[model samples]
Target: MDTREKILKAAAEMLAEDMGAKLSVRAVAARAGVSTGSLRFHFPTQRALQDSLLARIYEHLLPGDPIRDPALPPRERLLNCLRQVLALIGTNEDARTAWGATYRTFIEPEPTEQLRAAYLRHEREAERRVEHWLTVLAEEGALPPGDHTRNLRFLLTILNGLSVERALPTSQSVFLAEAETLNAAVDFVLSAGPASPVESTQP
Candidate 1:
């Protein structure tokens, strides 16, 4: 494979391994059988490398293009978008571990400024993805007009809570399947913003 492809493949493998959380440029270079200089020559900076890896992971999880599918009902499209978000959070053990590590890094007693900035950038992209889908619904007259930013935050916040709950051990007192919970959450969020006139008047 080409040098850039090799580096990215090595990086993806690293993120799936136990050492994923402790990922560093040096470690990635060593694992890829390339010198640090070669790695930096391709990636230039740690943030760029991290972003590339994240983009790769996201693409694998949701291979569909972000463009809205006009053939599908708009709410179905929204649920599909939100389902992709859930997959990102609770797809597999490797992803769950990586997410837990990311959370730990950010919530440290005094997270480094660099870490905080990088995390914020990562989160902003996720929020933007949700907003983009919602914006499509709004434009198509499938969703009500409202504060896009606030609605984006609200949906993401609920998904975040669900992710955390999924990671925890189930209690005898309370149990909800992921499908049931997700469907209910999606319904509630859609309800908050009244359906567009076109949808409301439909059979």
Candidate 2:
């Protein structure tokens, strides 16, 4: 394999083995059997390397992301993408287990600097993914121009709430309520300003 590919492979493997392990230049270089200089030549900075690794993970998680499909209405495409994010959180026992693990690992005990950094890195990655979706819809003229950062935060806030709901007991089906909430959130953003006229596909 090529030098760059080898470095990425080594990095991915390291992460798979232990998601919390730091991907330091020296460590990745050693794992890849390449010189630090070579790894630097390919990645230049730690952020560059991490971003590439996360992009690979995201692509694997959502190959041919629905947000990019022109055949579907933009609203429907965005909903599909958001639903996929929730799917990763799972439901019922799966969601409860995830929450329990998170609390034990990061909350029950004093979190170390390394642990905090890992959590922040994950949060930033979520923000990045959400921003990418908003950008795509704006480009399609299906969404109005606005402060994308604010919009991203707003959307993620709703998602975080929905994820928590998945872990809790409820008398009614959360799926139907989740869809209504997602639709309302999408509508609010789409109506924030005058979007370039696009043909309506919504019933």
lDDT tens readout by residue for model 2, 1-203: 99999998999999877656679999999999999999999999999999998898877876778898878998888889899999888999899987777776567767889888877887899998988899888887877665587678889999989998999977777998999999999888777733345579999
Per-residue alpha-carbon lDDT of model 1 for 3-32, expressed as tens digits? 788888988887665322445789888888
Candidate 1, number of clashes? 0
Off by over 4 Å in 2: 111-113, 169-173, 193-203
Poorest stretch of ten by lDDT in candidate 2 = 189-198
In terms of lDDT, the best-performing candidate is 2
After best superposition, candidate 2 residue 148: deviation in angstroms?
1.6
Clashes of each: 0, 0
Q: What is candidate 1's local distance difference test score?
A: 0.71
Model 2 global lDDT (CA atoms, 0 to 1): 0.86
lDDT (C-alpha, whole model) for all candidates = 0.71, 0.86
- Model 1: lDDT of residue 63: 93
